[model samples]
Target: MNILIVFNHPYEGSFCNSLLNSVQNGLKMASHSIDLIHLDKEEFNPVMSAQDLKAFRDRKPVDSQVISYQQRLEKADHLIFIFPIWWELMPALMKGFIDRVIFPGLAYDYANKSNTRMKPLLKRIKGVTVITTMNTPGFIYRWFFGNAIQRALIRGTFWKLGYKNRKWISYNRVKMVNQSKREEWLVKLEKQFSKF
Candidate 1:
């Protein structure tokens, strides 16, 4: 499988980076081709400019960066997103990537003239996985906030684009976990991704 990993942590030595490494190693073990997009390292612009909104409304391309990202998305059979959950949401960089790359006429389109529903365009993508770390407990994040990331990415984005096999792996209380526990999580991630 051609797997595209979109990573969005700012710090290089962070646990999210470790998680990204583990995911890459596992996918490599399975002999899957990997394409990585390190958003912070790439210095991606997260803000939507007036020109971007205009292009979107006009059904035109946003920019070269977004076009390149979309081309990567088009070639990948599986997609993975690794990031830290901040304030119960994705980082601004990752959100902006979604807004800009997953544009209309690319990710989805109107079913008919009635526009009753959307038809997904990226049907070649077989699976989508999200790995997130947070300081809050998993139960609270799920029950209280209703797993906002899952809803946004899986339902709002991938599912709307006709993807059904979506998985979410969240490491809660990351700041409180010990190094040994973090290693164990990495091993678990390796095992989980080997099956993919």
Candidate 2:
């Protein structure tokens, strides 16, 4: 299987960073091809300019880098998103990355006259996992945000894009966690990756 791991955390020593490494190592150990993209280190712009939108709609052209990312999504069998949950939502850069790169023609197509239905372009992908960390408890996130980013990515996007077998693992209350708990989470993540 080919896995594309998208890491959104900017900090080098964050727990998200560790989780990214764990997932990568586990997947590689499982004999899966890995394409890990650190969003903060990438040179691609995250802006969706009006001209770029026009070009996308016209099916003319777009930034080659964005096009390449789209192609990776098209080819990968699994897509993993790693980030820290802030304000009960995804970071601005991560959201912008999605807005700019996963454009209409690339990720979806609205061919029907009513525009009520969309054709998913990433049907080749079969699985998705969102790895997130938050300072608040998991229950709080489920109560306040109702797992906002999870639903948005897993249901609003990937499932709609024909990705079957969606899963999410969130490490919560990291600020109050002890070393033991942290290691436990790491072991759990290692096991999760092993299953892939």
Question: Which candidate ranks first by TM-score, i.e. highest?
Answer: 1
The 10-residue segment of model 2 with minimum total lDDT is 59-68
TM-score of 2: 0.91
* Candidate 1 Cα lDDT to native: 0.89
Cα lDDT of model 1 by residue, 1-196, tens digit:
9999999999999999999989988888888999999999999998889999997877676689988988888898989999999999999999999988887787778888896678777777888899999999999998999989988987888777777788888999999989899999999998777776
Q: Taking the tens digit of each residue's C-alpha lDDT, what string does model 2 give over 1-196?
A: 9898877988998999888888877887788999877788885576778977887778654677777788788788888899998998888777776777767776777758897777767766777788899999887788877878777877877666666688888889998999899888887788778778
Candidate 2: stretches off by over 4 Å: none
- Which candidate should be chosen as best, given lDDT against the real structure? 1
Please list the C-alpha lDDT of all candidates, in the order they appear.
Answer: 0.89, 0.80
- At residue 10, candidate 2 shows an lDDT of 85
